[model samples]
Target chain A: MKKNIILASTSTVFGQPYLSYLKEELEILFADAKEIIFIPYARPGGISHDDYTAKAAAFFKEIRVAVKGLHNFDDPISALQNCQGIFTGGGNTFLLVKQLHELNILPTLRSVVDNGVPYLGTSAGSNLGGMTMQTTNDMPIVYPPSFETAGWVPFNLNPHYLDPIPGTTHMGETRETRIAEFHTQNSIPVVGLREGSWVRVTDHKIKLGGPLTARIFEQGKQPYELSPGASIEFA
Target chain B: MKKNIILASTSTVFGQPYLSYLKEELEILFADAKEIIFIPYARPGGISHDDYTAKAAAFFKEIRVAVKGLHNFDDPISALQNCQGIFTGGGNTFLLVKQLHELNILPTLRSVVDNGVPYLGTSAGSNLGGMTMQTTNDMPIVYPPSFETAGWVPFNLNPHYLDPIPGTTHMGETRETRIAEFHTQNSIPVVGLREGSWVRVTDHKIKLGGPLTARIFEQGKQPYELSPGASIEFA
Candidate 1:
């Protein structure tokens, strides 16, 4: 089976319903999938796993596909192993990564996706599809055992990437500055996936999707943009 | 010796010179001190330790206090143990925490501050004065050994705190929402210190300083505003 993945910057764009922006693309990506295993470890505002899962389920229902929360399974490892498709929703990356590591199924989840099961991720979920979660914009509300994530792609991701607001006085590190700091400590390339943008993978080929351009950061080099439909491979 | 400390939200406000806003307060805080030990580990924008220290030194020069970087001393523990005054400049909290833990000087730094060393922290430095660094608003560029900090105060500090913008398209977590998430995971109260604001601790009497009101977040409770010069007690 060939790999089919869509790692999006956000589940919902501003002034849009959740997952509506990607409706057409997802209809094709999950064409053959009978059901999607939803991992809701990252939902924010203190939303519970079941509640988060139900929210995803409600969205997928419009497409006539069933969605099941990974937590609902008696054996999550087995559920991942047998699931036809997977969809991880957006929330806190640290909390998601921590829960996945603690459940001792991070490797299983990674392996299943690597085996070519159709996968979809948004925001924090998209971060998990990268080589590591080091470039995540989420706060370290909880510390994960390791910063490692699924290495389905060669590079790391900076989801919900925003350009510096001009004439703004906010002193917090901008998304670009933060990614630059990550390069100082690690050599991994980072994809600053903007809202409505995503990285689509099919088999061995990977491409940037959506209308916007994706920002690319590498060690010792100026950041550049990868236009939509361009390959995401790094040197 | 009483705990005479100042944990500021930022070293420099938007339109002011670095450390100038706290000039009068700092002079009174370090009134009897000879020199101040400067921890430049948190300096941002890819600045070096020596350069960061020099910047801090120039600021303290007005007060006739010599600022020395902790990296310059062969024995940082000894230098910290005997320093009359201490100032940890702001930048990246994770980087500072990582360096302190790697050097195995975290305990010593905490001990010295707890023993009334007239400690001063700004931004990232202020985050370290809390019970833990989990509430920091910094990017985790590097993973530290632990989320622990100096615990100089009973609660954590969220420096450079900003309220939610009224008409923004950005979907990232607001400072208030992020602090609410922190409360879900931990019980420590978090003081959202706006830029130009600070927490002043004179022994057991802790107060919010500056003109702006500090936002306070406690577990399972609605966040509220704390007026300047108001007591910062959680209960």
Candidate 2:
């Protein structure tokens, strides 16, 4: 079965326009969908389940879509089993991954998507769909034990991308240098996404969204920038 | 020819008690020392060569010490090869490791110690003597091109350890839990050391120093705490 997956770069509720834009995109992708399964368990930033549910309810009202929070749904596998579409709201990617891993819902989540239930993720949500969660800016403030992450997408995504600070003389290396170091040790590709931007995946094809250009770092070759609307084949 | 290696946690200027303590420890370790070689290139926290040299000059006044920063020495390996003792001052461990890895000095440093050079490390300097640099709380504020680290000690050291916050309700796990998680995935043990505390190693025997207790985390076993002066065999 064919399904749509939306990966958002952030979980800030203040970004109403971005959420609206994503909702519009998902609506077009799942035109015949009658309900949207909102997974707010990824929000570990002290946001209550009621607040998340209400936010989703308000956003999807124009489509008259039924919004449901999965916090009380202890059985994530079963809850996600027959869902028409899955939308992952963002907060802390590491926290989300920790819960998913602890509950053993990661594999099941992948299976649900394989069974053709569309998946939508933002920020932390989008992070889960990547090969590894090492790229997120969230502090390892809390330890989930292992750095294991879902390997849905081929490359790691660096959300909230920014350039180097001018005239900073700290002994530590900069973010770009760190990412470059990661590329040196690992062969994984990294996608630096800016605000209001996302990666749209359908039927195994990945395309860029929004107006900013995404930076790609690979070994031996000079790092290149990909403008929005650019498409790349991931093997 | 037995040599001495002193690994200091911080690079101290003249008249600093910490620097004097380090020198005293080195003197005791190498009672017959004729010269002391200083490796100040390892100091990366905006510490200039002259600044470190001046610090060394003050210490050398009272004792028979010859300070030679690695950069000024004709052949670092040769200088270390025939030195009576090598003193490594600290600043940023990651930066130190990055430079050492780049110049391929780790293997030689290890060899020097294997040849009976009593090696000592403090703070970030002490971190380089561990198997992995994962435990260092230094911010990955800047990214180096690689995570390569000096693999001296069998376990990773978490220097400057702090307990969990009293009333904060951070969603993520605490530092202890995180270290445990690291053990689950990797077999390496993590030693959580607080300031003023250190682990003294001699011929593969590790002794806890200072007043703080060192916590050890391993897979499947409950985390254990070791008091100061507790000794463990580490290769």
Candidate 3:
């Protein structure tokens, strides 16, 4: 059996309701599953785990899918193992990775995903699917036990990746520059998933989804754009 | 004697030459020092440490102060200890902290600052003087041994701090939201130092310098602004 996954740049694009843009794709992604477990460990704006999970539940409710937060379970590891599908929402990557490491479930999460359990990840969640959390745009509000992540995919991911705004005076490094710095210390390839874009992984194939082009970063090379539907498997 | 420090939000303001905006202030700040060692581990854009140091040296040359890269010394610890003044330029905070911890010189750096050796830091460099690197806006491109920094100042400093661009449709978390999230996880106060703004530390007194007002974030309280020369010691 092949692994199935959808890694999105964000849960919601600008002016859109939560998860609304990805609804149609998500329907097919979770078509066979009646219920999906949600992991709310990232907790945006430091929202409570229950409150964050409730937000996810509300979204999944619209698609007629039952949503239960991983935190609600007696044993999160067991809950993950038995789940048919899992959706991890966006927030602080460090916090999410910290909780996953502290709970000693990174291996379990990877095993289930490898076993063909459908998975959906947005923003920080998508970042975790990569080799490490080092490319995250989120603030390092908390410290994780390790920078290592699920590595469901072979490369690192830079989610919600933005192109440099023209004529902007902000002195902060561009997303491109930040990732280049990442490559300085790491040799892994990085896929810069723009807003409204995603990567769909089916078995060994990974293809870019959504209308925009995704940027690819590799060591000692200029970053280039990949059009939607382009195969990133070779990246 | 009191510790003398200059923690600027950036090396240069937009449209200004590198370190040009701070030149006048830097001259006064380093008036008594003939030479200052530079720490360039945070290499911007993955530039080599030597190259980054050259950029700093060029700027300091105009002020007639001899500059040397910390990496030039055979022993970084001894280089730090024997230096009359030190300047750490900004790039990526994680890399900077990683090198500092790996070299086992964070303690040495802190002790020198506490002992009143002249110090100058901009952006990543400035963030290190804070309680922790929790408030840094830079991406985490590497895993440092620890997030603990010099803690020379009581509160954390958020450099290159930006106000949300009005009427923007971007859904990414604003700078304010990111820091607010930091407050949720940590109890320490965070001062959002905007570009062109800096904090001058003399003994126990910390006063906002430069021409702009800075935003301060404290747990369970509304964020407020502090104008130039405003004391942040009690924040």
Better of 1 and 3 by DockQ: 3
Q: Which residues of candidate 3, in runs, are more than 4 Å off?
A: none
Estimated TM-score per prediction?
A: 0.98, 0.55, 0.98
RMSD (CA, angstroms), candidate 2: 10.0
lDDT of 2 by residue, A1-235 (tens): 4536666565433325436656667677567668868877655434676797778777777776777787767676788886777778766555677677778878878877756677777777787777777666553333443445555667887766656657633223444665665554457787877666788877767888776688776655577888888885544
Per-residue lDDT of model 3, residues B23-103, tens digit only: 888888899888999999999888998999889999999999999999888998888888889999999999999999998
lDDT of each structure?
A: 0.90, 0.64, 0.91
Best of the candidates, lDDT: 3
Q: What are the per-residue Cα lDDT tens digits for candidate 3 across A104-144? A: 98999999998899999999999989989888999899999
Tens-digit lDDT track for model 1 on B1-235?
Answer: 4799999998988888999999999999999887989998876866889999999999899999998999999999999998999999888889999899899998998888778889999989998899889888777778898988989899999998989999999777788888887877889999999988999999889999999999988898889899999999977
Greater TM-score among 2 and 3 belongs to 3
